[model samples]
Target: MGKVSTFSPAQQAENTSSKIVVALERLSEAFRVLLWQEATQYGLSPIQIQVLTFLLHYPEEKRTVTSLALYFNMTKATISDAVKSLEQKNYLVRKPSETDTRSHSLHLLKEGRAIAKKVEHFAAPLQDAVATSPLKEQGVLLDQLMQLIYQLNQEEVITHQPMCFNCQHYTEKKGNYCTLLKISLKQANLRVDCPSFETRED
Candidate 1:
């Protein structure tokens, strides 16, 4: 039963999990294609566009090359190269880090915000498709996705995720509860990224 391979036609056919994994891989491919199309329009690499998009929403503390490298699971050199290109294109600036004077944090410029807004919609099609699903079905899918992501984060497969399931406030008491928020969370209430997240190592 342990011998399952999503890439193998026979195994994927026999195993529902394998088939779902294959579907996820296809979705990832779709994401890459969308990112490429958006990047090409602005003469930016996919990673550069991603960096701009991320910097647009994230706070300054999380906008450093090191943090970006970790979040994207890419090498520091790769993220730095992307940052350099963005800087050269007048899209962002590097300000000295408030915490570490020797280090720097990314600041998205006005032009970068405009470009990021355009490129960030690269995944709008996927969102629209998901929006078409029944409300309950979307909630179920969100639960499945968040649990999978939480497991991946626990195993260190996904390096950085500030999700509800991994937050200090999270609990399984009477079906998902937030100790800090003092609220019970349903599958639909689960958060993929919560700004108030405080990491809990358990």
Candidate 2:
């Protein structure tokens, strides 16, 4: 019988690390696919459904395409296309921003609101089902996950530069803001430090 050469300690460690990374990626990808499938079965594309759901909670804010693009880490062209399609489908309306002549805002139409409510109602049961774990264990797990997220976000804030230091969208005054947005410039600048920040074309 021929004896096989076993992996060295460093090689074994590398293999273990690589396996962990791949497993994590696979798990993430599976979750994404499952979520996408659920959204699609509800007769809405994932992005459309997300936009609809977001607008329901913050109906007063007529968000611009640029803002949505930045928030979603989506391309300007993709946002523009989605906005156009939604507008054509009568799910949303594009109107000129009252404050900024150069920008436009998205408003969900009445029909869009109705559809969003229906979709959200349908998904609530699934959400509940997925979260119906033992209370004590669930609480502990959630708390730990929240702590992990907070730590990760804190690390991001320390590592990333704030937009206030570079982006023209930021202003120094207590409540100064871009003409297009209702939010304070300081808050907008703070968003740059977010781990999720994505650039948008103005």
Candidate 3:
């Protein structure tokens, strides 16, 4: 067998950011491969599985095709196809929107919910590895990732999604709060993908 090469940070002294790029690419590819394997067991595409998982976690109002397209950074047509596939498989159901009878909202069926639960844990290996790290280190890693995502959104490199910290509705005074919802926010309650997120003007 051919020898596998590893990334060498020492050789990338001239451009340290190259190492981060390589690491991120490798992590993304690894996760995609693992997700694909898990998706195939249910005879579903990765995007379809992702939709089901999103519906499982998000409220019904946020499960519209338009919202999903924006969240996944895919075109509406592509998201429509995936939704149709899931519907045909009886993994998802559509109900007419209460506010707009012409539009529909997606909901996962029992089978879809089961698959979502399974796929959700498909990254247990990665999670287990992270679990071995010190808590402070883990927090640092999460914060750094969140910052990177925030930067990407700011740059418009990816479609904007609901993140409490980046939303106009978010307020920080004596404590974190949501001005629109008039609710206090806990650190753990900070949503990474809020349905009601409105971008704050710079």
The candidate that achieves the highest lDDT relative to the unseen native structure? 1
Q: All candidates' lDDT scores? A: 0.89, 0.59, 0.82
TM-score of each: 0.94, 0.55, 0.80
Residue pairs whose backbone atoms clash in candidate 2: none
Candidate 1: tens digits of C-alpha lDDT, residues 1-202:
5855579999887889898989999999999999999888889999998898899899878889998998898999999999999999999999997678989989988998988888889999999999999988999999999989878887998787888888988989768899888999878889988988998867
Q: Which tens-of-lDDT digit does each residue in 11-55 have in candidate 2?
A: 446576555545556656765676577577766677777677666
Off by over 4 Å in 2: 1-27, 121-126, 134-136, 150-202
Q: 20 in model 2: Cα distance from truth in Å?
A: 7.5
Better of 1 and 3 by TM-score: 1
Superposed Cα deviation of residue 41, candidate 2 (Å): 3.5
- Top model by TM-score, which number? 1
Candidate 3 TM-score to native: 0.80
Ranking by TM-score: 1, 3, 2
Flag the better candidate by lDDT, 1 or 2: 1
By lDDT: ranked, best first: 1, 3, 2
